[model samples]
Target: MTHPTLLHRARVLAQRFGIDITRHPSDRTGDHLVRLLDRFEIDTVLDAGAHTGGYGTLLRGSGFTGRIVSFEPLTAARAQLHRAAEEDPYWTVLPYALGDTSGTIELNVAGNAGASSSALPMLPRHRAAAPGSAYTGRQKAEVRRLDELWEEITAPGERVFLKLDVQGYEGHVLRGAGDYLDEVVGLQTETSFVPLYEGGPLFDEALGHAQRELGMSVMSMVPGFTDPDSGQMLQCDLVLFKQSDAREAALV
Candidate 1:
């Protein structure tokens, strides 16, 4: 008996099921980021929880010519991040996690890599949806306060943009960024509508924290993760800018 290859089997199955797996949300979300970049006149970016430097690649490919300081907590991802940005003078990757305070934190490394790895644990719902995202192990990552690194990461007069894809730890990162929120013009963050990770904030709480407490307003939102079976949105990425008279003027 001969076994069919995975690609061949998928093609046959797709024809039978009328499925299209080629859809990508980045085509839309990437456009949104570019518009926000231009609208805010952003020249610098703070990329938190950058995995394998994917976001950096997206920014460069989308024609963004600015300085990007990316922070990754995992060892393997940081190694990949270094290689990905080696040729780009404006892109730099650091081997540390950002949190509410400066210290060491244990990261639950996921076997799937795209799964949640945070101070909190994964709940049953997330585990069931993506069983391969099981915790393979744990690693102690050196954490840094974004405020302490702000001076070193940016030029003297640069207006900053912030992107947070820190799984379930977005709130912790935002808490740490309070001291320098005024310097930032825009923010993009991932929020989950459901309880994906144990102790993780829901979508409303996370968005409210940024809007009400951090002085940011949601400008646009795009679908992030989705359930292929039910066609339900699991997560989304929000584009936000600081709420101030200056921001209103810039948009006008």
Candidate 2:
């Protein structure tokens, strides 16, 4: 972040040239996410796979002041996540992974800042494409079912938005969400196009389960993990809203 005076001057200079530096045609994921939450009157955000509070920080930076409960299992990352939310009274960080059941699981720690760390085994394609994302070690992590924590984390009638970034564990998290999925108004999950993780569900299966079983319709698909050489998108973030929501309502 630049100094306030310098930022102001830069904005002023850009405005004189008939341009808005802050507004662009490229990906503005944060804006779209916050807009959806606001439109649906979301009171709380359940960040199912928060890694060092990145998504939670994105929400706060995107002007979402609602309560955020971020769940992370990695010890180091969880510590960092706690520090990130320490200043915000409404932001909370938990040291548990959301999965199909409550227990412990072995996580494949990635070599690169634990960004690629996942409960599932990393596949050769992922390691070959990004060496830094390869597994370096293993760690045991506590797991929790989202359904069991739903009522504890939220109040009745409070609209909720659940965000999942669990590498290949989207299905597990949703299954754990169970009947509480009906209570959620919207969600965003990272869907894999290939087998980046062993036993991972591919894009079509993930999409079908979300739409058919979860009762959601696609809102948007944003390119996420891409192969540097082949230029193929291995994963994408799929944002969906409940089919019961007012799709005909004006977004403007």
Candidate 3:
């Protein structure tokens, strides 16, 4: 929670960008996100970690009127996410996980549900950072490459913005997209500085692939999680834009 005086100042700052942070101070951050999407003319979003529609809800509340296609693998979470978007004509929810390959995979369901669920095993550092993020159990879920469902997730002439919040499985999601990456104009992925999930790619590996191999350039990065005691950075959400050169060449 932000201090009252600090939060009020944040709201005042956000108003400069024509944003109202009274609803959610975090929504103030959406000003930058909205600007980036608008810059790319993005009108569609591929939400990899739908997780009860929290991200989509935030985006819509922040004044984005784009079509949102959300992916959630957990049965319980998908049910809630579906209910949340049931009345929204532009929002759609899918019950599946995206990975490097298509098949069934075991997802570790976190005790707290949405925030910590992942295909990879949780590490000690994760528990140390967030004690409530312990795995409760595992469930087998359908996994597919984003490319395989590209047509279903997107519509014609809709520039896509991809958001990957898949605990530590963002690398697998990116690998699965492969050539489909060309269709995305921008992306926001959560990367970790410390190992939170076993066998998951850290910030360098994930950022390297997106920049060097996928032709995305870093636009912004916001710290996500930090150790309360040591104040050590644990995770961050990285915003990236597809290189103009790749965009033009791909368009050709």
Question: Best by lDDT, which number?
Answer: 2
The backbone clash count of each candidate, in order, is 0, 0, 0
Residues 1-252 of candidate 2: C-alpha lDDT, one tens digit per residue: 856676556644543332234443233778888887887788999998788888898888889989999999998888889989999999988889999999899998887678788999989888766766777899999999999998889999888889998989888998898898888888898988889998888999988987987779898887666665565768888998887665325443
Q: Estimate each model's TM-score.
A: 0.88, 0.86, 0.85
What is the alpha-carbon lDDT of model 1 when measured against the actual structure?
0.79
| Whole-model lDDT values for every prediction | 0.79, 0.83, 0.82
lDDT of 3 at 222: 70
- Model 2 earns a TM-score of 0.86
Looking at model 2, report the run of 10 residues with the lowest lDDT sum: 16-25
Model 1 TM-score on a 0 to 1 scale: 0.88
33-56 per-residue lDDT for model 3 (tens digits):
877776677889999988899888
Q: Name the 10 consecutive residues with the lowest summed lDDT in model 1.
A: 12-21
Off by over 4 Å in 2: 1-27, 246-252
Range of the 10 consecutive residues with the lowest summed lDDT in candidate 3: 12-21
Question: lDDT per residue, candidate 1, 100-155, as tens digits?
Answer: 89989999987666335666788776665556566789999999888888888988
